[model samples]
Target: MIQPSNKNRIVYLDVLRVLAMLMVIMVHVGDAYLFNAETMTFETEASLFAVLLRSSVPLFIIMSSILLLPIKKDNTSFFKRRFTRVVIPFLIWSIIYVFLPIPNEIAFGGPANTFTDSGLNVFLYNLMMVPFNFTGSNVHFWFLYIILGLYLFMPIISPWIKTASKRSLIFFLSMWGITLFFPYLRLYFPQIHGECDWNDFGMFYYFGGYLGYVILGYFLHHHNRLKAGQSMAIGAILFIVGVIVTYWGFIHDQNAFFKTLALSHVENWKLIEFNISFLSPNVVIMTAGVFMLFQNIKLSAFMKRVFTELSVFSYGIFLVHYIITLWITAWLHNSMMINPGLEQFLLTVLTFSISYGIVKPISFFPRSNYIIG
Candidate 1:
């Protein structure tokens, strides 16, 4: 699972970050069609496509782990750097989203959850609650919470990861893998292995969630010894199997029309949550697969520079692209007579490019990483 490095840079990770960003946009684009459509036929099938992209956040987390694990800096420095790099930018944008009136009325008419323009009281409430959750606002902002938590937990686990043997990691991943199936397990038994209202600890309680991905990424980055061709082959198999399972499972459980990156449009959100949760086994498998595939990417010098720039702007692009995507989706749906699939493609392209254009310049301003990161 050890990641190979090229001269002075890890270009494959850069490529993965860019791919994840595009996948995220595609997820949002699929959401636009699913929620806006009058019925579920085309829109629902298309939205189901987002299951393939569910690994986007996991990819981001894994990339973070690969770069930050082993705790090169002290906890204080790590946290301080993370705070400036992520939390500050997140707050600025979140505040911007809360105050912006874009959600009140899409210029072309679409989703209002884009931003909060309800009133002073509602905006304040959302702002105040921002410290706690991302309720009644942009759902994508939820990534910030998960990432922040992972960052906090990083130092706690770093020592264990550094000293742990291969068997130790394997055991941890096995337990974590068991937790991945907890979503399906709960379908048959609600309180499995001591998980109940009074006591939330299950058999693999500590091994669940995105932390597994952190360790998984660490293990892969430092432990795997396979050649590029072999790794890619295995990655392809895993990714293909993952895609099949993810798509079929989500589609099988889904019949009623509903849809996102927000599943508010889906009438049966429980099914959506169960099969496509980012923490599920299938998604994790898919994440591991594509991540492995990306590890062996070949990049030209110019392209390497380009991917690096895109990676740097990726976080800001993520925060700002949603609004632009909403606008683009509404305009495309209202003005264009095109296939939903084609529209989604164009929507992802245009939104991603436009967001990059906006972020690249702002990223150069003084202390802008805090604002744009």
Candidate 2:
């Protein structure tokens, strides 16, 4: 049985995680709607839906940080374990996806720059590109690298983080500030990009996420002042507010007087756009909402059992599921051309079934369970 603690293990984190994973899957499925010739442009109804669903990615990152944070260990031990778990799978999949070119290209939309004639060899070189991320070759797997870097620094960072003092809070806020400002530096002050250090979380966006979830995780593990009911109420309110804000901004494109202030901005009112990926204020808002929902809510027996199982498979599900999405997209483009509605429905069903189904059997292999879980 899973043990509960005031500041430690929280069931709601897992619940939020499972929900976030499903949202990611749903976002990808919704993305398929875009591949349709009629819906390729920004103006189309389906395209707008795709844009709205982009929150799923940020949600996944936020949830991952929140869940992964409480797994406290020494720096060396933490690195060893996380490397064996998150990084190893990322590397293996990075290679497989590179050689096969089956799923990654489709899911992430090809290499950002040049593709070479040498297939396997070029991919190996691309794997070497992992550390720097200059070429942006390993795309999604870059997150694993970045997160691993954060984990490495956690030994030093954690002590400061745990201090629970004003100075520590300043440390975190300062980190958040640099993260927010760096991208702007790249845009307006191009020279800074060359001089600035590029560690794993140094990417700013990932750093913010790393900080947010880690802090939240620490807070959750250290404090249990709120009961489940309280968490749920807060979560519900946050979710409702988030929905209203997202819908107001994206769909209606009208900033109601109050909503305008709700938008992220510095003191001078230079608007914060596209910062969710980098841990914008909106992300913090949504994170609170998601966190509350998971903490406050209890699942029914059926859902509880299923979520338990699903959460077990989430790692593997995350790893190879995109491959399923890619193949589904391919199948639709190749064979399932008739009836877009049916094609989409069947494609989603088949993708989920195959991905989820394969996870268990594949997980049976030695040391494999860590890959997805």
TM-score of each: 0.89, 0.69
User: Best by lDDT, which number?
Assistant: 1
lDDT of 2 at 1: 30
Minimum summed lDDT over a 10-residue window in model 1 is located at 103-112
Q: What is the lDDT of candidate 1?
A: 0.79
Which has the greatest TM-score?
1
Residue-level lDDT of model 2, residues 165-262, one tens digit each, is: 65565566567656654654556765442354443333345445455555554554445357878877877786666555554444333223225755
Off by over 4 Å in 2: 1-9, 35-40, 43-72, 101-107, 114-125, 134-138, 165-210, 220-224, 227-230, 247-278, 300-303, 333-350, 370-373
lDDT of each: 0.79, 0.56
> Global lDDT for candidate 2?
0.56
Q: Give the TM-score of candidate 1.
A: 0.89
